[model samples]
Target: MMHVPPQAADARAKTGIPVLDERLRGGFPRPSTLLLFSDKPTEKRLFGENFAVQGVKAGDTSLYVDFFRAPQLARGELKRFGTIDPSKLVFVDATSSQLLLPSQEKYRISDIGSLTNIREAIVSAIEATAPSRIIVDSMEFLMDRFDKDDVLRLWHELIEAARANRAVICFLFINWTLLEEDLAQIRSMSDFVVEFQSSVRGGIVRNSMRISEMAENGIRTNWIPYAFKDLIGLTVYFPRILVTGPFNAGKSTVVRALAEKAISIDRMGTTVAFDYGNVNITGIEAEIFGTPGQERFEFIFKIFAREVSGVLLVIDATRPEELPRAKQMLDLVGPRIPYVVLANKSDLVGALSTEDIAHRMGLPSDVPVIPTVATESKGVRDALLLLAEMIIGVR
Candidate 1:
């Protein structure tokens, strides 16, 4: 027997979602099985589809076994993620009989009534195609119809086949049936488990994902908020650059200027929650989150402070007395994260110089204090670029 080393970071499959890929270090390990379980009606299939499409985008063959959706319907939905080469994707159609659609896939299950047919169709495709990646959407279709023990046995065999082929496989399942013991068995057999959850607040939907189990790095983190774009599929992304400062220091102005489209959760011209905007500049994608300047909202800092990639501390250049308060706000973001100071209102009368501002804030000599007029976007892009470079270690 020949021994094989674990997949390297660059060699791991890219999930096509930058933040998720970053959280995964690169992507799921090759020949590993991941269970995407969710009780809520979240976009679970979007994640699985993105994973399969990413493999196809990498010039590798991918297999998609559909139990709930027909082959055409699945392909159509996947196109919303990105355009893929049709030749690279092989579909195992187990729903055609139930859907009353003619089977055009490479492998077809003429009779979905029998568990043996489902198992034979999937197993044969896995062996014959030996694809680099595989996705089975809605495993509930099988578990609902077949015996639990038989389904588990077939699942284990598929896992073995994936390991032999050195392919990454993902199963999307809704947590409705199956006893707790059987669920535990399924989880134990998987290398990773990702769960999706969603909520409605103020008539707006917010989606998030939690990595419940990852055998490689064993990461267990809080629910990471995410959103989806029309053609870009699912994004488990929030590379945040926090802009915080004293009251009326143009923090919101800076956020609005940097964002292509922005919204502020303000009450009576004061941000009660936060200001958010998405920015894409020079190939660097980021989300700018501006915190409220008043000390009353200081308690809310801990909520949005996790996984901060960088910071842009905005301050009024004319108010040197508020420098300490601004420094205190920066402390809330914690140390060791790269940060740059923005002396806003530099165009105003009697504004303090960058040197004066830095000295008053007691910042180290190496920390940058850039002057800016946030309302006019003057010198704002420079401050953002500096922070971006600092985050990437290019500065």
Candidate 2:
């Protein structure tokens, strides 16, 4: 009997999206095949494009097989993710042949009508460039032209290529024409299947994704809401980080200080509804939703607290009497969800110490109470960083 050492799993390749990377336990294992599928009309290709662009940004070679758009158009869209080094990216343009346009890319699929041409072009590029990542923009082009058996054979070849080169390959598919059995077979071949969908509620469209299957190193399947930002792609994002506390605690001030841009729903110099702001801090991206501190507007907590990643319990340090009301607001956010105390106006005369504030609130010793002067943005970043760490369970 031969004693053979088990091979170590491939190193993770981060997608440049912090939250999504956290969900993948750092990122996807190299050489794995991912099927990014959607049943509804959604921006599924953006996920795959981001995957390739992430590789290129990491100084690894990436091959993008574009079936729907021109190479120039694809390049333009890639700019939304971030600046890229063109030398690191190679394109297999399948669109040029269909449009009868001269392909400017180095690698060209000369004929889209023939499955053999598409397969050969893709395989040759995979072998020639040896990309660390590959993305087939959409399988619709191949599906519309070739038989299922032919496409299946091509799919097998893709898997084999990924295996041979230790590269991750992602196939983007919109599930309108495919039969259930066909979809099942495709899923069976993939190492990970990511299903995404979008819905509009209250005139706001929300998009989310979930890993439906994983053959090994199984994932806890959950629909994680995400959004694409300019120069940052596919964030497993939360649109709200409920910032709440008692009146005159600087909830709105903290939100404004933390956000690059903000809008407050206020009248008569008091927040009547909520303060909304988009925050990108310490590599964690989220929308900060600051609740009105007055007890009368407590009903609005139902609107802002939903799907919040964490809470920032703001209270005026000078007024320790407000600590009880601040603690009460935490109940609205609920238990089990991590939060940090922000003792704002700490620099004011006769302000209570962080220890005194926690004691007054009857919070446990481990509960962090960070002092801040929202007017000057003091301790604001630190408070946000601590809350972010707590939300991701890094603390």
Candidate 3:
């Protein structure tokens, strides 16, 4: 008997969601089955498409089996996220007889009615393309067309083929009309299950996700608010990153410096809900969030703390008295997450040194305390760079 060595265990790949990837330890197990379930159109399909595109862009061949959407429409939608090499992405159209031409001649169609023909078409696509990753846009459509047994049989064949070829397979399933037994069967065949749902609370729609069956331990994460940007893709916009201090502190100016463009959601020059900005920094690639220093909007801390990679706790060097509030907010985000303190408005007269600000904030001796003037963008870059390092854990 040939025994496979334990060291040969395949490494999982990240799905690009940092928090989610942490939950999966590394990422989804390669050459394993994954089921994406969502009843409503919560961008679940789009998420799967992007996941496959990421693999293809990384020089791995990928196959997208679309059962509902036309091939051209899918390709067009994917292009909005980023450029995908036409040579790397191949599509199998099980929806239409007419081949919706892709940017290149890499896409093909399978006969919708013939089971044998469909299977052969899939095999040919996989063999010809030699894809490292595969996504079936939906299994629900396949279930609707064939009997449960036939669908299950086809699924088994596909899973076996993917395993033999060392390819990861993602199956998308819409759960509206699916019976519980069918779902159970699908779950049994999958190594990972991701569920997306949307709820309306107080006239506001909120989207959330949960992951189950990702390895030995099932993973869970706090619900983070996200919105789909048409051209840029998904973004998490936290409303505030409170920068508080005594009177004459440079909290307002600090907000402006860190953000690309910011609005002081304050009244009479005092922040209420806090400061808001859609800031993006090069090489770091994250949403920059800031808050007000006032005490009234302390409730917003709970919202901002969720799903945060790291915190940038900014304070004023001129006001040593305001250091307590910065410490208080740091405690709110918990100690496990990395954070840095910024001594803003340092260019002004009588501004405390970086060491004094750190000591006053009760921050760790090694914690970074950057001195800056937010208006001129001085020290802002360093503060953001430190935060990014804390997020990815290099610095």
Candidate 4:
């Protein structure tokens, strides 16, 4: 294992995830080391591949060193990240040697059996291309075959090589037989660590990731639920977010402002009985459910609001008199649920300030009271994002 030396704050090699990049204070710091560690066979490599491609999109040549898959297979798998500049993607063909075949790539690991040869091949690529991003698909292959001390020495050399070229290096490793002390050493050596996990239920699989910065005063995030799309690589996911508040607080408008397409049940085109829609923005995907504010439709709120991932409590900022009704509606959904208060109609003359609204509603300081003009789509996305962070348990 290698200790990540301190460097001045500089430009970053983004993770290609807008949500994570923003939280990372503009992505992984340049010339940094990242450890993608998992206990089992999780999709941790996907994040590394995404990070490499993002750098290519930024006009930097990238070096991808794979141990498990051949160059052709690796190229095909990377296409799932969408169209990339194939010319910018350089590969160090390590698999061809095991197959006892001549390689076609610019850099080939001719003698895969020797750790020194592997080191030379990788360092040669880094020094030659001066790539902005480098990824070692899986380190366990070499770790298992070579001496552990020798492998750690190579790890240190690679990190130093990447730093010399001003590149962000990522290593994907799945724990096989490492001891607790060894694992802790690996965690301490890296500048940043991103972990992946998966669970199966009823023939469905859910994936999530957690990020931690190893430096002092660094931020550690909760397990953020995510999914992969056809063209989009990584996106945060939130299912069953409830939108409920007092009647005429413009819940429908809030839903409409947030959702791409929405379906609502209305009586006489007046009071909305229900609203349901899917929202995707800034690399986040969510299913939103809106509930009518009237007491008669209380049954509807009862049906869908209990198991919600989060809540968007919309209230008319101009109609302070309806604050009590809004409080009652919020109470119906129960307490201790992660919710965001949206001061809708904030553009109106009589609209109240976010502070005043929060004070009047007796909300805690940690609870955000965002002012929004749903009709104009103002402040809506911010409120949802804040609520999503809260639901994801971001500290």
**What is each predicted model's overall lDDT from 0 to 1?**
0.80, 0.82, 0.68, 0.87
- How do the residues 225-254 of candidate 4 rate in per-residue lDDT, one tens digit apiece? 788877668888876799999888999999
TM-score, model 4 to reference? 0.90
TM-score per candidate, chains pooled? 0.71, 0.77, 0.68, 0.90
Best-to-worst ranking by TM-score? 4, 2, 1, 3
Candidate 1 runs further than 4 Å off: 1-10, 99-101, 237-242, 247-253, 261-276, 280-313, 316-320, 327-395
Candidate 1 clashing pairs, residues 3+ apart or interchain: none
Residues 139-251, model 3: lDDT tens digits: 87777778878888988898987776667789888876777897788789988787888777558676655567755645544444445555455543332233444334565
Least well predicted 10-residue stretch by lDDT in candidate 4: 1-10
Best by TM-score: 4
Question: What C-alpha lDDT, on a 0 to 100 scale, does residue 337 get in candidate 1?
Answer: 77
What value does the lDDT take at residue 282 in candidate 4?
Answer: 86
For each candidate in turn, give its C-alpha RMSD to the true structure in angstroms: 6.9, 5.5, 6.6, 3.5
- lDDT of model 2 at position 95: 85
Please give, for residues 1-395, the per-residue lDDT of candidate 2 as tens digits: 22222225747778776655766777888778999998866877878887888889888889999888888888887888878899888999888889898988878999888888888889888888888889997886677778879988998998897777778899988877888998999999998898889988678898877775466647645566677778866665666788899987899999999999999988999998989998875346788898888888878987777767789989999987787788888887888777999989999899999988877778987789998999999999889877765665444
Error of 1 at 137 (Å): 1.2
The lDDT ranking, best first, is 4, 2, 1, 3
Any residue pairs clashing in model 4, and if so which?
Answer: none
Candidate 2: list runs displaced more than 4 Å.
1-10, 100-102, 248-250, 261-274, 299-311, 315-395
Winner of 3 and 4 under lDDT: 4
